[model samples]
Target chain A: MDNPNLEDLLIACRQGSDDAFRKLFEQYHMRVMSTAYRMCGNIQEAEDVTQDVFLKAFKEIKKFREAASLFTWLYRITINLCIDKERKRQRRQKYHENVDVDSERITIEEANSNENTRTLDQQMWQDEIQSILQKALSRIKPKFRTVLVLKDIEGLSYEEAAQAVGCSQGTISSRLNRGRKELKTLLVKMGMGEEYFQER
Target chain B: MKHGFTQKNLSAYLDAELSPDKVQKIELHLQSCESCLRELQEIRSGKAVATCFENPDWQDTEALWQNIQRLNISTPEKGDVKNLEMKRTNLWQRLIHPRPAFAIAVLLILFGINLFSNLKQKKFQYQRVQLDQELSYGFDYGLYLDALVAGSPAIEFERRYESQQASYEQARSQTTFRLASFTHMPKTFQLREVRLLKNACCRSVQFSCLENSREVIIFQQPQGHPVTFGNYPLERIELNGQMYHRIKTGKWTVLSLQLKESQFMAIGEMNESDIAAIIFAITTI
Candidate 1:
């Protein structure tokens, strides 16, 4: 919001400047992709959500008021779209459980094979840790997960997270509290000891 | 300093979101209260762990932008925007300059419709209550089991099995139907708790499993006594000559399948892959 170049780009985007839109996408796509990835817990789904978010922002660029920053607006869209995607995935799962059963089985087998092929080196260890953390995060309730992703992972301020989630700061604080506790319990259960999280 | 800081306060403290005065008070309290200090450490550790989650590399910006542009081929023309603005203005003008007679007529019609709909709704409610009373042992029973798994305080019953084996043994002794034991489970899940569900007409045993931190409940009842989830559209799938029914309620997925004389319902917020794996584990076992 404070960037004059961003403001000019926004103006140009509103005036149907594709170049300006491209610039804006390049600036914020990584942020959006990261947020979506953490929220969805799957890289493919995150990519899909990122695409949808940009498409939605482009389509509704004319209606974007300057009351909120472009980042916050795009974030709100990303969260809403991620949530929608989650719901649709749940619904789709109900019907296509068997149809994709074999593919999922193969994915699990491939993951196991990949783990075996990769040496237990530092990078593999890091990837394992990241995978465990993601699994724990995916187990959390969506409301709590979103807050954690936006505030903790994405490094959004309390005010910014509240604006993006369309909630009061108090709600965000409470959700963050619960989310952190749940994540800790999950991490501990997933073999990440409490001491691992503690500072040296 | 009468009590330790609330979780919200401690959480905010970790994020440096507290006011100067509040931060000073918490710091003062943290020195004296080991319990509060530990809680603060745990919260900080949790935040640190969360911060360690790095964003994955996403190098598809150009491709994604191009896809967006391709999908947005029908961009609104300048004339279209002007027409939309004109229409919005006209709508505002009409709202500002309403005819009193037309407004009164429309209000009267709306009032009449509201009255008629209210009457109809009352009749429908009466019938629904009657239907619910009849299906209380069926539809409401499933919800009661769900509530129990969710740990709803509204339930007056306080019966829980001491262990999984005890639960299975008790259920086997009490019910005439065959109890299906999950000899095999998905690798990611572990059996956590078990509870017995009993009412006037039917009996069931609820097995709760923990997949990571999420709770998955599997309910087993006699085949003839089906747990009906009222008004929720269920998707039916046929696999290996057995029919399975599934439905999504919010984030939770309810999947029920019949095996011989036992009816099994598994409810959890699991992906399709996990659900399929669970189904395979159950069916194969």
Candidate 2:
């Protein structure tokens, strides 16, 4: 999977070597899908973003220089594309097709059923914590959500998050703060304060 | 500090982004203030929950997608309509306004392109045979083999030749070749084409060989010396069981050699059969 020649293969691809380009695409296709899926938080949207990123990358790869590693370049592109899609998503009201009902209720039911074999306290608390977190995450704006994902989830630094979204570090720093604060507010509302928010 | 901090500033403090002075101030304030500290803890927990989404089982689809790329197959089976129509695209329109026809067309073109490229032999043949027919070209080859490995030059004349990128309508281009000999060969170095300035900088003589589908590129960069890509001389040497030509002076390596029509560079190392097959492929083309 870690073929050092992947970059060289990409160069050949940009040079119109169809064979080389195919190899490059195959090597990174799933990783790109994984990243997109994680960022978008939905299977279909993830698939769509993955398809879009690769298509866009294929078109613009000729302009890609060795200024950045190929994975970094692709990572930056995927995040940007997803962020763009997300902003647009916010403008239009979004509804989850499958999980349209109260997510917390569904999670509680699922948790209760799954934890039947276990003692009730541990199972109940786990379900309660998860539902609280999920509901809270759904309330934040996409910008903050993106920063949260990249930083906490993807573990990117402020500068890297900024570069991915085409913003200044100051913006990322601020947005991340805003996101964390919102999460805290939501968590406090859910009464999961001590379990999850004790150290925030 | 009166408001304690903005939501963002407090969050940043939790993330440890504040400098020493700022960090100290935030810590002092948060230590005394239970409300903000509680908010901070909540935010951190929420942030941790979000990590669950970070690394999902995207790996399951990895194989499926890799196969897609390997097969170079676009399932939608639609011709590219965007490039066909020549629609406009930029951040502004792409963001607020997406051209479905244009976007889909662009997507279609891209998908088609990928489908063609990834269709290596292992995957489904798909439409590759048809696409390959469109892209494939005839080959005519030249052998500096006669002169590829010979002597070394001290004073070298290097040249970066002209290059052209082909378009969809024009996938194939004729290759050009030239050869010249010098009094001495440089020890071992490749002439770089990547950093050359606009002008051809060598004292070049004008000459042309019979036109063919092969290009034998020998270029060099001499410290404190000027070289040109025109008709400069070349030399050859056999080093470590492989033959390389040093054309026209010091520190030149074979930049690249192309064989046309169903042929490939043995890449960095080649045996006799590979070399002969390369020649055969070019000749057959």
Specify the CAPRI tier of model 2: incorrect
**lDDT per residue (tens digit) for residues B134-241 in model 2:** 112221112121122211111111211213222211221222222222222121211111111121222122112112213222222222222222344544444334
Candidate 2 per-residue lDDT over residues A1-200, each given as its tens digit = 25767667877867757677567667766666766765565667777666656656666677787634566567777877777777788689665533433555455445546655336577445545554555566666778877776677667767667767778877887788677777666555444424344332
Residue A18 error, candidate 2, Å: 5.3
Give the DockQ-based CAPRI class for model 1: incorrect
Instruction: Quote the chain B TM-score of every prediction.
Output: 0.35, 0.23
Q: Write the per-residue lDDT of candidate 1 for residues B48-76, one digit (tens) a residue.
A: 78876866666666787776666565445
Alpha carbon lDDT of each predicted model: 0.67, 0.49
Least well predicted 10-residue stretch by lDDT in candidate 2 chain B: B125-134
Runs in model 2 with CA error above 4 Å? Answer: A1-10, A17-31, A69-72, A83-103, A106-139, A184-200, B1-7, B32-35, B52-54, B59-285
Per-model TM-score on C-alpha atoms: 0.51, 0.45
